[model samples]
Each structure stands twice: as C-alpha cells, then as structure tokens.
Target: MKRRQLVRGALAAGLTTPALAALSGTRQSFAQALTRPVQAEVSELEAAAERFSYGYQGQAPTEVLAELVEYFDEKIPPLLDRPQSVTARMRLCRTAGQMAGMAAIVLGDLGERTEARGWFDIAARAAAESGDQQLHAWTLARKAMVPLNYRSPREAARLAEESRQIAGTTPTAASTLAAAVAARAYALSGHTDKARDALTDADRFMERISGEQRADTWLGHCEQKHHVHLSHALTALGETRRARESQDRALALSAPTSSMTRTLLLIDAAMCVHRDGDTEQACRQAAAALTNVSAHYRTGLTHTRAMELHRAIPAEHQAEPAARALRQLLAV
Candidate 1:
C-alpha cells in the first residue's frame, strides 16, 4: 500500500493523524507486513510523525514531553491492547516502545525520575511484546541515564552493562547509543577497564551506523551526540584533555536552537576545566553557563550537572567568590 493509503486506513480504523507516528523521532520496523501493512508503514508513518515533531525539537523539555505524553495517551491503548494481526501487533509494539523511550528520556532530563521509570517500564513491555532485541536493549540503555545523570551514576552501571551484552556485535543506532551511555556509567563508577571497553565498543558500533537508522533524530545516533556522550564519559574518567576535544566537537555540531542540549554541553565543558585543578575557573564557568541559559530550558539535568560541579569543588575553595556565586545562584 502507498503511504496515503496507510494513513487513510489508520484513520478509517480510528487512529488519529499520521503525525502520531512521527513524534519521538519515532523509528519503527516490523518483522513483516501484515494484511494491515505493518512493516511497510513504519518509515512513512515515522516521516509524517517527524513533520509533526520537528517544529518543537528546540523547545523546553517540559513542553516537548507534554505533547508526546498526550499523543501517547491518545494513541497507545488501541494500538497495544486491541486485537490485531501478528504483523500489526509487532509494528505497534515497536512504535509504542520508541515513543515511550523518548518520553522516558525527556522525563529523566526534567528530573522526573519516578515518572521516567514508569515510562521505561512501559517501553520495556512494548519491546518485549514486539520481540525486538535492539529496542529492548535501547530501552534498558536509556533507562540507565535516569540514575546516572539525575540521581547517582553508581546506581546505573548494571543497566548499562546489560545493554552492552545485548548490543554485542550489533551496530544499530540504538545499540550504539546504548554503548555510549554504558561508557558513561562505567566511567562514573570508577571502573576504568569497563569504561575503556564500553567506550571502544561505542566507537566500533558508531562506525557501522546504517542507512536504516535516523541519525538526525533523538531516537538515533549522530556524530554530535556521540561526542557529547564522549565528553561526559571522558570527563568522568578524568581524561580532561580528550574531554575538551569532544566538548568542542559537540558544541560546533550543535544546532543553534538546541538550547537545552547546548546548555548541558556548556556545563560538561566546565567540568572538563575542573579536572585540570582550576577549581575556581570551573565554578565561574558553570555559573556562567547557568546564568546564560533561559529558565525555560534549564532542565533538571542542567541543574543536576551544575550542582555536581559545585559539590566537586574542594572544600577550601568553596568559600571562594565564584563558588559562592554558583551556590547562591542554584539556591534560587
């Protein structure tokens, strides 16, 4: 069937706009096409959904998550619970899992850990239902960031490890992302050997990203995002010089409107300076990053990174003017 025919059929079947599939940078594929065209519909449906999703890519996390969760609520129940053919079931599961994973990631960025965990649980179920090993691995890998970034990295290493094991040898965009996040978790946990292994794995996987993946979207990998994750991992491992290079690459590659990500990148850059014994300069840099960021895009992840930067300052330097400035700024 043509894309138009599929969209019309979906509407005839009581589904909403094609944009429903487009949200979450939604990438989907079925093991096969059902009588209902499940496999044949993923890429086209996702394209429409992107048109709907593209306008808000630069918005604040809160705004973006609201729209996605709203669409998910409207669309998921029938897709997931209603009776459907085998191929349709697999296709819907893949779609739901991708959307859920993206929601969970945004929720994590906002520091809504409990909510994010709930979404990841649903994504996990969807992945299982779809029997998509890569989706399942990606969901687990994305879940790791909730603890590592918003709470404690120590709590996240295991999830990352599981993702790596599942991603062993596959070079899908999702698997590459899992590997990158796994490297961060390992680095933060002080596991130098594991961190090295995961980082190498991420690099290896990155080289094999295929045309089937949507590297431009949040649902997939891009060279810029790869570097951003690298900066975080390298900083965690105290490889400051290497971290700086990655940070620079990420910044250069960043979209001008991507304020939230760019802001977080700036904070990561500040941490690189901290690793160099320039505690005072790092504090000033972080405070400056926070200062320039609009309140709209200064998400929980943003504050979390800045706070971690503050706490890492040596006690003796805590009384320094820049340190106090950062503390007072965050307190508000």
Candidate 2:
C-alpha cells in the first residue's frame, strides 16, 4: 500500500493520539476548502511514510531509516516553505514537524548524533511555527534522549524539565514523555530516589492517558511501549534488580515482535543477570542475543549493551564457548 493510505489506516485504527484535537477542527475546515482530493493523497502519503518510518525504529536496518530521512528531508522543506495554498500551510507544517521528529529518532538510533541534533532542531522549529505546544514538547523530550545516552544526565534532566514547563496544563503525553526522560536523567545522575519518583510519576501519567487523550502525530506509538523504554533507561543506570523487574513487567505488557528490539532486550537481560553474578545464565543469554544481532543493522544502543555484557563476564568464565563467542561478536 502507499504511504498515505497507511497513515490514514493508522488514524482510522485509533493508533494515533488526540493531542491535535485543538488544531484539527480548524485545520480540517481549512483543509477541506483549500485542498483538493489529489492533494489529500500527497498528505496521506507523507503521514504514512512517517508512520512506517517510526514503526520500524529500533527494529529495522539503519539504511531503511536513512532512506526515510532523506525522503522527508527532500519532501517537507518545500511544503513548509512554499505551500500551494495558504490555508493548508499550517497543516503541512505540523506534518513536517512530526516527520522531522521521526527522522531525529532514526538518526539517533543510527548513531548520527550531529544529524540527529539538526533534525530535532528542525522539528522544534516546525512545531513552533505550527503553534503546537504538544508537538514541541514531545520533540524536546525525544531530543533529551541523546544527552541521556551520552552520559550527560544533567543536561538531559534540564531538557526534560524545560519540556515539562512548556507543556503546561495539557500534560497527558507531554508530561509522560517528560517524566520518562527525567527518570532516566535522575538515574544516570545518581539520584536513585528521584529517579524512582520520576518513574512513578511517569507510570501514573500513563495510567491516566486514555485513548481519547490528546496526541501528537509524531508520538503515535503504543503507550505500553514507554514502559519498555523506561526499563532500558533503568538498566543503563546500573539498577540491575529494578531494571530486571521492570523488564519483566514490560515484556508481560508486550511481546517482542522485531528482531532488533528482541536482541537488544536479550542483551540487556544478560547485563542484568551478569551484574547479579549469574555468569552462566548471562553467558547463555548473551550468546543467544549475539546470534540475532547479525540479522539487523548495528546500533550504538545494542553495541553498548553487548559491550556491558562482555565486560561483566569474569576472565575465568570467558574461557567458555558462549562467553568467547560473545567476545568475538563484540570485537566485530
């Protein structure tokens, strides 16, 4: 199916949040008058492309994401800078911002830090121009993940706080996003209690977020997936026991579907087990995980997790075939 058809399907399927409700009524009216059926096809294609691009994240090859990013980068600028109709410009800008946010995430996942930062800045600018505070906040929160990954937890915390402040009273998705980012920041900064508190706040916010709550086009993933992302952040902070517990909860909430995501999680689980001094099990899981990594594109997140598992194995244990295999995988 075409990209636009896919986005329409996603919207029809209720996969998207209602955060754009405030803008939708006015934009819809304007869109109806200014845009022809032919233009609608283009819009739908743009939205669908973004949706598929985001759906494959953490699971697809880097080249796939790179291709999507290039497509958006080529397609959106002209639409935003020179819309065929004034009435449709706002809607186009909003959609462009959402696509930009997806690109940022893809770039970050692929370890293209410089390009990711640029894309995130573009997304923020597009959100501002479209007057969508929710999109702005979501993009900012997503951008904060870069710092968190780089071990700059303080910077990540500041960005998360900024996002929360800007989000104001419409705190459903934005607040949840901010809380998740803040939780990771606190954990990385060695504020365990604060981290736990932030995570609790995130969970509470998530509970209150019903299907009818506001939504951003760019933040279209399932709410349950946030817990899995948060669990990984906890693992990064060295809270092995908590990370394991959270991972179990996340897995119970949603089964792994993507090879890359499953491999990454398995590696994480191995790290937790290794940290807990279960060398035998860690080696087994790590070896199993390594077998899958070759199937997908390499990502910094996965590489780092694999490195952790590699370092966790004791020298004596390294002599085992499984452990030796993991070491060889990391070396490559």
Clashes by residue pair, model 2: 4-44, 4-45, 18-214, 18-215, 19-214, 19-215
Q: Give the residue spans of candidate 2 off by over 4 A.
A: 1-42, 57-59, 83-87, 212-218, 236-242, 252-256, 311-324
State the RMSD for candidate 1: 10.4
Count of residue pairs whose backbone atoms collide, per candidate: 2, 6
lDDT (CA) per prediction: 0.79, 0.70
Query: How displaced is residue 184 in candidate 2, in Å?
Result: 1.4
lDDT for predicted candidate 1 compared with the true structure: 0.79
lDDT of 2: 0.70
Compose the digit string of candidate 2's lDDT tens values, residues 34-93. 554535745774566556544564456576666766777676665545436554666676
